[model samples]
Target: IHRQAHLVEGFSEPFRRAVEREIRRLGVEIWAGCQVKAFGPEHVWLSDGTELIAQTRLWAGGFQVPSWLSTCGLPTGPTGALLVDKYLRVQGSEHILAVGDCADFVWGSRLLPKIGVYAVRQGPIAAQNLLRLIRGQPLIPYRPQATVFVCVTVGNRVAVAEKGRLVWRGYSATVLKNFFDWLYMRKLKPLRWQEFFY
Candidate 1:
């Protein structure tokens, strides 16, 4: 993985270390803090003047919102995410709402990071607030939790989970991650619960 320092930043220290250990166990070389300067047909040059010979190259740097958001005439942040209020409603427009990675939710003094946890939590609040607006009722304000759960899976055997100061890893963590995935899938298809149970 081409990550700088922490494999999964914002997660607990133990969680990050566990993921690093698992990835190393899988024989995957981690070029931490090393930036790709150039790529040739058979090798890649690093920022530190080192060259790595590889056949396949995968870029897993980060993510950004679509560039078209800026062209939509919406109030966007530096990352081109639409500016949204606490209720996930677009700023200066009651009818226009934003959610998920496309929204730059203003939470207290900082904009919330683009993450699935925040998006999952924002979904219901946005739906309720939209209904309230249509019913002429008061829109409910969103209050994010102080801590969020983060899990990273390495291959199919190893995983790490972190919630605040608590951390779990190894096969048990992988099982937990799978359970969370099942829960998310269940939310999308309630009828699939039977398939999940069996």
Candidate 2:
């Protein structure tokens, strides 16, 4: 169940369709543009006057920040995430930087999506900028790439990959997704400075 008709927003049309197609193929019904009116022990009512009888329901809707963000007296967006400039620095604090899901980094008029991929890419750049700041050098601006690839795991064996207009699914996509996941986890392992180069 989702508010958007497309599974992934701000992605290419072909990619969004591919994700929806794979999801339906897995025999999971998708309720797009659905507004949950009410819920009962064994059923859920939608705004469209449709009652769905289901034994299980999962609410994967929206994101929120910790209450302490507001209490900290830092500038925050409507979602309560810390407002940050192009360099990922906090609005008023030169030493403090914000990144990941807790930050509201805007490019032009749009705020960047709160996704893991952006956060992963932002980390190294943020670190570099911090070093530059420490050396009294100009900080490098964080310019987000136009195209961002995303992979979604639909089920045990099914997954979807999207990069602009390109899309991939099924077993190969699942393997590719798993490979990326493994690579991410592997990088998290503690290693010596010499091991990093190797």
Q: RMSD for all candidates, in order, please.
A: 3.1, 5.1
**Each candidate's clash count:** 0, 0
Clash count, predicted structure 2:
0
Per-residue CA lDDT of candidate 2, range 1-198, in tens?
A: 676676677556777788888788889888888788999999999978899997788888566687898899989975689999989998998988889888998888888878787999899989999899999999988888887768887877778887766788877777777776667767888544433221
Q: Model 1, stretches more than 4 Å misplaced? A: 1-6, 12-14, 190-198
Candidate 2 ranges with C-alpha deviation above 4 Å: 65-80, 108-110, 190-198
Candidate 2's error at 17, in angstroms? 1.6
Candidate 1: worst-modelled 10 consecutive residues by lDDT: 189-198
Model 1 clashing residue pairs (backbone): none
Q: After superposition, how far is residue 27 of candidate 1 from its true place, in Å?
A: 3.0
Model 2 earns a TM-score of: 0.78
